[model samples]
Target: MKNFLLLIVLSLYLHSSFAQNLLQPELEAFYNPALRPFYFGVASGDPQPHSVVIWTKIVPENLGLQQIHWEVATDTLLQNVVQSGTGEADSSSAFTLKLVVENLEAGTHYFYRFQHEGRYSPIGRTKTAPEGEVPLLRFAVVSCANFPSGYFNAFGDLARRNDIDAVLHLGDYIYEYGSGGPRKKKKNFSRPHIPNHEILTLQDYRTRYGQYRLDPQLMEAHRLLPFIVIWDDHELANNSNVSGAQNHDPNSEGSWEQRKAIARQVYFEWLPVHDNPQRSIIRSFRYGGLAELWMLDGRLEGRSPQAKGTGDPALPSASRHMLGEKQTEWLLDGMKNSTARWKIMGNQVIFSPLNDSKVFSRDPSIRMDRWDGYPAERSEIFDFFYKNNLRNIIVVTGDVHTSWAFELTGDPLNPSKYNRKTGMGVTGAEFVTPSVSSFNFDEVVPKFVTWEAKRRFCKKKNNPHLRFLDLNHHGYMTLTLTPERAQADWFFVKTLYEVDYRFKQKGGRYIEYDGNQVKKNKKR
Candidate 1:
């Protein structure tokens, strides 16, 4: 009987050993001398008044567990350490580790790094949002970073700047399309996506993210500053909504729900974002009394089908919702209760209506993918602000691939009805940043100059509220907020094709809410 018990125990021990081996397979086969275990580098996000999330991924040479030690210090030399801890890196989460270092003082700059097996990662810098009162706040805004099209010079430029508090990545952090698309034919891509195919599965998404993070420019941007990000269409699929996407084919891509789940899982795992029970990405961040940034999600959670064409009469239906009921309520309540001097909406798409009558017809032709498609919902939001007496609202947007500064007037079609002198019918002001690297109208058109001239003329003639427009440029915007006024300085890179590109100050504009006024500022 004793011998039989010993045999059973031995069998159990062997099974346990096999399970561990299965979870962590040999990594030597995939090892590269140049790629360290911390190849993806370090990143931090979701900053609060007292805490922030620090993230790192361990690429082990073997499948065994790795113990990662992290430290947060007031100085860059690690001499003045504030918080330190250790965590395990295992295969359960692609060997990724995220630690929420809490109980730190607010409005403070902190340096962080991770060490594994005696090898230390590059140090990262992060800062927590201010708590009570802040005299000033600054943020660098960017979006739509397509790796294959060009280099991330804009990100590198932003990384070089030391004035911004945090980086706001509106969306399209990574494009899922593989090579051989229309873009590839137009211009030779500097690099091709891994797998060389459209990503559809969790592993595929994770691999794509790994490839993007490998980019030195992008990696440096993450290493230098904390990023507050939201996923746009290309992160999952092109023109993606809640139920379906224009790029996703159900029969070929398998289940849409399953694909979305996989994409969301990978996004949450790879990014240093904090997830809630409802799996919603809509959240708010306050910078003391200076400003409150409401980062919104317009693609996934509760969006309806995009209008197909220019004259989709049903597009005006109230049932065609954008933020849905719950999120809309949350936004309205948040704005109503917010006491910050400036309420900045970190939105993915253009909030103000963009009308192009000459291009389409005498009637205003709107892009269905933006807020214009859901006319009733857009009107409801504007009405809420008007009725509630909300002021000092600044909408910072991306996704249009062009730079524009406009006043969100009540009647976008007929700007004359709204008094531009007093900004009487204007609810807010919008500053739309150009694409980081994605192709714009000029790049896509055969006759770039003619197309640009026509576009600018038509846009300006129809949309009088549009104070400025730069249809072709690749760069970002830096927004600075004070107690009195908020300013947005637009900067454009010399070129996206070159790795080492210089950014030039394009222009800038600011809004004063004391008397409801918008003005263009030449200062950068």
Candidate 2:
């Protein structure tokens, strides 16, 4: 440990990790180390296939200012030329250079590489979204990755898949808390974080992002494809809403606005995202005419204080809003107005009915903090889809740290007969992707959890409109969207504690309940 500290300090002394000099050899450690090592790492995000963002950072001996060259190839052999470019990184943005390459065949796999200080980064590969209404848009959905809970074996497998198009991370990208239980810091960081604990400042958030970005599997996944990202509570504080957070007490932690601003600053600085003035991440992206992805900012514009959410578990109110007025309106307007054949909402929370046990006599306010918490808001959204006949609508989500695929039901006027075989509201379909590696019910509520997956599955098949639900396992789900169908492949990882990150694959079905009225993944 002392040797590691010595190395870090020496690296800092020779070349600043936060490079103060602007004209020196750019890819320096102090400016955010993108230095090469025995281990090869490369990354690309914010992808449009032909034009993608490639980034790399290194720690150098002198850490002088340097210019790096980037090349994008038509073939892995690099013999066939398509597009190539050059970019220089200095202390300004922390030694990371994002090269935007252009003009390639639609829906193609292009190899990219970076050249700096005579060292080459690992060959990074990225793909473009299919142009026309092709058969699939297979990619993973994940969130809330706490490094100590486990490894990102799931990310490793997803990165190896040459078939996937992208990754949709529905927030909790990295937790804002200190090491808990098994998840420990790789080393004692130089500067102590805010509150001597939780992240409440720019430096805190930046440190967390840096640690997460250092994960080889995570970086590999990002290098291989475009990532559609959104943040949930933990990015700032657990169970946070517009007003405050579950992890913060204004009396103890300072003003909520100040903490929020710091969180947002680090997130925007690290991630490639557009600023939403509405204070929500309710934005839309398209894949020609096949499908349109509407990512939500469920945390920022939501109603309710931080503690009253899942942490409170009993405050289900018709008036407790999640997507606040404006953002909810934005989501509705987008859903109602989109031209794509399939409408996929990247919701951070589960959007379907989630009940505990088989008890049908319990009150509706049983499950709080999720869509179950905001009954009225969920109703309005459900009614929009049902009334307008929004076909092939699927909500992909994360944050529960457990996997669930549900046949979305409708408003049960009295909230009774919810678990009954009949007399229930069933609207669309929602798939909840588990966390990359957060503790599930098995670990926390072990005795109560079961392996049958029946009662849970009943939540899907019982209500005429509900479809599927898997409450265990931590992995990502891939969706293949077509004009006539949209299929989801729920891939699982074998283990998260192991260091090598070996993963196993699980088979998941795709739904085609629109034109053909089938509910299976008929593979290409």
The C-alpha lDDT values of all candidates are: 0.80, 0.65
Give the TM-score of each candidate: 0.90, 0.79
Off by over 4 Å in 1: 1-35, 184-189, 360-366, 415-417, 447-461
Tens digits of per-residue lDDT for model 2 on 3-25? 99999888877554343332222
Which runs of model 2 end up more than 4 angstroms from their true locations? 1-40, 58-66, 77-81, 88-92, 99-104, 181-196, 272-281, 302-320, 357-366, 412-427, 451-466, 500-509, 515-524
* Number of the predicted model whose lDDT against the real structure is largest: 1
Clashing pairs in 1: none
